[model samples]
Target: MTLILFTQIFVGLALVFTVAAFGWRLRLFNALARPVDRSTPKGNPRLGILYAFTLGMAPWAKESTRRHGIAYLRGVAFHLGIFLVLGILILSPWLYLLPVTWRTLLALGAALGALLGLAGFIARFAEHNLKALSTPDDYTAVLVVSLFQASAGLWLVYAPALPLFYIVSAIMLVYAPFSKIRHCIYYAYSRLFFGKFVGSRAVLPHSQQGAR
Candidate 1:
């Protein structure tokens, strides 16, 4: 079997392990007891949840986001690139079938993400506030993710680099659940609780939707 073929196999296995680990973590979180609010309900919890996922995420919705708009947008773009690259990975078998134009677009998108990731890394290392807030895990995660995105960008530009991309992807996926990256998993729960509290209290604009 070709070495490239072997890399694909390894990448597939790594994906499976990463998914399983994430699932296990999710199960544990769900099994834990959730706190119940004793206060009388005044608003619709559903509306709060809607806001959490929607308007609440808007840059203008938060003071911090307003102050750090560029950084926040960079993070949003980086995450979008991450998702796009994962899609690209799944399309690996058929990637060469695409038009050169399409491939170039994909390569450019991933490259932009990699650059943003690197910028974030440098910011954390050089910025006084960010440097004080960062942990070793933050540096490791950003560097690996940056490298992974870089590999993905190159792989799209050159088909022969597929093996390298797969290898890098495998490393990042395997470490994701164990590293601080697992916080992505908690995003849902956080939103849920936010919905519950705001929806219950009739505080904020959720009252427009009426109590659930």
Candidate 2:
């Protein structure tokens, strides 16, 4: 088989595995009992959920994000880049059909995201608290993801690098469910739970605090 064909197979299997892993996780999460709130809600849960997915994610919304605004923004950019890369991957077979300007823009975004991922990886070791809290999986996941982003950017710039990008993508996808990256799947659930807890107590929107 040709190199491109092999890479394509690897990526296809990785995608299939990723989907199955997420499905299994979803089932497990669903099996867990969801706690019912018996207390009278002082604030609207719907509003709280809306805020959790929107304004509540702003840097100024939380003390931690506000204090570490740069870090938070970097993370946001990195994730945005990941999503963009995924789109590019899906359209890779016809990438040559895309306009040059669009390809360049996507490449630039992937490069920027790779840089941000590198910064995060370095920060894990440079920041004392982060260094203390980080495990081997954290370091490995960041490194693999950064390399994947870098390869993606290079592939966008030079078609010959497609194999490298595909290989890295396959590795990242296969490792995702077992590593710290799995948190990406659970992030929404965590936010939903937090919104429910805070909303029930009227702690989300300060205006609702008085109603409690």
Candidate 3:
């Protein structure tokens, strides 16, 4: 088989394993005994869950995000780029059919995401408090993900560079379940639980339909 074919197979298998690993994790999480709140809820748990998935991501939604709005936005950009990369990978077969201007715009967006991710990686070392709080896994995860974005951006610009993108993507995907990247999967669940508890307890204001 050709190198491109080999890498495609490698990445395809890696993607499968990554999905399986994440699915297993979700299964385990679901199997865990859920803590029952015996207290009568003062507010709506459903409303809280809705807020958690929506307004809770707003800069003014959480204290930390509010305080570090720019950082939060950078993270948002990086993750958005990741989502774009996933879309590109999935639609790669028809990439050639896309208009040149559209492809260039998408490539630029991915490149910006890669830059933001790289900036975050640098901040982990440059910021004293952040550096102190970071572990090896944190650094490794950020670097690999930044590289993954970079590879994706390059592949978007030059289709001949696809093998590199696939290989890097394979590595990132395989390591995701074993590293801090797994937090991506857990983030939603944590937000959901937090919103439910806080809203039910009337601890945090829920972003109800009329309010949001």
Whole-model lDDT, model 1? 0.88
What's the TM-score of each model vs. the native? 0.95, 0.95, 0.93
Report the poorest 10 consecutive residues by lDDT, candidate 1: 203-212
After superposition, which runs of candidate 1 have C-alpha atoms over 4 Å from their true positions? 206-212
Write down the TM-score for model 2: 0.95
- lDDT, candidate 2, 144-175, per-residue tens: 98888899899989989999989999999999
The C-alpha stretches of model 2 lying farther than 4 A from their native spots are: 208-212
* Residue-wise C-alpha lDDT for candidate 1, range 1-212, written one tens digit per residue: 99899999999999899889999999998999977888888777777777878888889888999999999999999989888888988888898989999999999999999999999999997899999999999999988988898998998888789899999999999999979888888988898888668866776454554533
- Compared to the true structure, candidate 3 yields what TM-score? 0.93
| Model 3 spans > 4 angstroms off | 206-212
Better of 2 and 3 by lDDT: 2
Worst 10 residues of 3 by lDDT: 203-212
- Candidate 2, residue 5: Cα displacement in angstroms equals 1.6
List, residue by residue over 1-212, the lDDT tens digit for candidate 3: 99888999999999999999999999999999987889977777777777778877788987988888899999999999888887877777678798989988888988898899999999999989999999999999988988888888898789899999899999999999999999989998899898898788766663353244
Clashing pairs in 3: none
Sliding window of 10 residues with minimal summed lDDT for model 2: 203-212
